[model samples]
Target: MTCQLRVLGCSGGIGGDNRTTAFLLNQNILIDAGTGVADLQLHELRAIDHVFLTHAHLDHIACLPLLLDAVVGARTAPVYVHATEQTIQLLRSHIFNWLIWPDFTVIPSAERPSLIFVPHELGQVEQMGELSVTPLPAIHTVPAVSFLLSSKASSVVFSGDTIGGTDFWQVVNQVASLKALIIETAFADKEHAIADAAKHLCPSTLAKELKEWQGTAEVLITHLKPGESEVTIREVLELDHIHPIRRLLQGEIIEF
Candidate 1:
């Protein structure tokens, strides 16, 4: 069977028709619980069984608490949230402290909690039915990671908000059957300095990263700053690369 991914949101900021990063994998697994999760109906929200967080950034984890609250009554089992140890700690200290949001991990009663935190390390792979999800290295303002989603036939790589670096491509180059690559380029070429400071990528930096990749996967850019998306895409297209790159759109689906 093929693994299907639905892009719920892929924008760097929120605005008209723009949403933060979130992806639905086969209807039950969420790659990130960003603002895009808000668009789902109550019944759709109830279908999420697992959430794999890239980091603890507000834009990435914004809807997680709200999602738990909305689906609590409908869920028969706890929703599993997988992330790095540091990311999980940040969630507990900041988000689920009962001050900012109710600690769903112990809410309704400790015996029947609504959420469970599952910590994963870099390079470790987790199996979800027929799909395999592996955490890859990411350089960001916080402890973050990219994800490699693979089925027996093909694989897709999601480079979560990160700077251009060799470590990520090192792992990505090893995927023999890579079908698609969804990477982030958060700023235009003119904002290269700002992008570097924030540990994000501009078109120029993205070009540098692309040089390390050897596969022929279809490249899709994501996380462009709302107002600067046009310029960013222009600069990305102007770059010299072997693979064709395009912007990732909300509501798009990719099956492999």
Candidate 2:
């Protein structure tokens, strides 16, 4: 079995020629269908069978309607959407409420809905073919989650918009074979006010958060606002070079 990571969208928003936050696991397993799904080839896109969401943020969930529209009839199996119960409710009420967009869950047929909801508890580990996934809590405007993904060759964590907590670091320190991390730093030093209000990571704060980590995985940064990516990255890189740090790029394919 092939297990690889395809970054569909890595930016915080659909700005600066970048798409919003989204990722694909082994091409068929999706994580947060942000605007980046718009870029997938039609045939390749139709092959997706699962989508794991991080939160109810518009940037993270924006592409669900569009993606469903694209592959509605083409999918042979239902697209399993896994998330916390609250996240699912928000998506159903706010996003797919028929007023904002048609509720795909009730579409076509109730028994064979295009999108299938699978409510998962935090810290519960589930297997999808060759992938084993666990959800970790994240601090955000709404209840959010980061993902711990493990395959035979390696394991990694994706911090989906968090403010860095003890639980997060505890989990990171426990993973023995973590190969990389894709964490967020959304604003520049000058935008500290905005970052604070939104509870997002600034470069300086992110540097402090990294102190908790002891693993040797590449500390790849992501979710920078449109134009502030470079400055924010430089600031975070200023920290002591214990682990390799780099900025994540859109469409970059990472192999374990």
Candidate 3:
């Protein structure tokens, strides 16, 4: 079966139609439970069984607690939240500590809670039906990872909020069937300094990162700050050697 990925939200911030990062994999899995998750109807929200987080940043995890709260009573099984041990720990310490939000993992009863954290190490691959999700290295302010989603036919990589680094490309170049690369360029060229300070990518930094890329995957830029989307995309398009780059839009879907 061909796997499908739907962009639930991809903006760096929230305003008007803009939403934070979130992607729906097929119908049952979520790549990140950002504000975009709110766009899903109640029925669609209830169908999410697994969520793979890239990091613990609020923009990436903002809607997770709400999603669980909305669906806890509707589902029979716990919602599986997959992330690195560090990310999971941060969620446990900060987000789900019962003070900020109810700790759904132990809510109602510990014997059968509404949510479960599934810890995955870097480079580990988890099989979910026809999809293979592999955690890839990422450079960010906190413990983070990218994801390589592969089916039997093709694959795509989501570089979840990363800076320019060679570690991610090392694994990305090895993917024999890569079809697309969904990456972040959170700032415009003028904001390169802020991008560097925040460990995010601007157009210039993104160009530098692409130097290590060797695959034929179509490049789709994501996470552009809402107001500067056009400027960032224009800068990315003006990059000297990179070809066929496009801005990722909310509601877009990619099949593989």
lDDT of each: 0.94, 0.86, 0.93
Can you rank all candidates by lDDT, best first?
1, 3, 2
- Tell me the tens digit of each residue's lDDT in model 1 across 94-123: 999989999998878899999999999999
For model 1, the superposed segments whose C-alpha errors exceed 4 Å read none
Which candidate would rank higher by lDDT, 1 or 3?
A: 1
* C-alpha lDDT of residue 135 in model 1: 97
| True-vs-predicted CA distance for residue 218, candidate 3, Å | 0.6
Local accuracy of candidate 2 as per-residue lDDT tens digits, 1-256: 5468889899987655799988888878888888888888998779888889989898898888888878898886778899999999998888898898888887788888898899998899989888888998788888899999889888879999888787899888998778898899999888988998898999878888888888878988989888878888888888637779999989788777
TM-score of decoy 2: 0.96
Candidate 3 residue-wise lDDT, 58-124, digit = tens: 9999999999999988999899999999999999999999899999998778999999999998889
**Candidate 1 backbone collisions, by pair:** none
Estimate TM-scores for all models: 0.98, 0.96, 0.98
Q: What TM-score would you give candidate 3 relative to the actual structure?
A: 0.98
Instruction: Work out candidate 1's RMSD over C-alphas.
Output: 0.8
Q: Is candidate 2 or candidate 3 better by lDDT?
A: 3
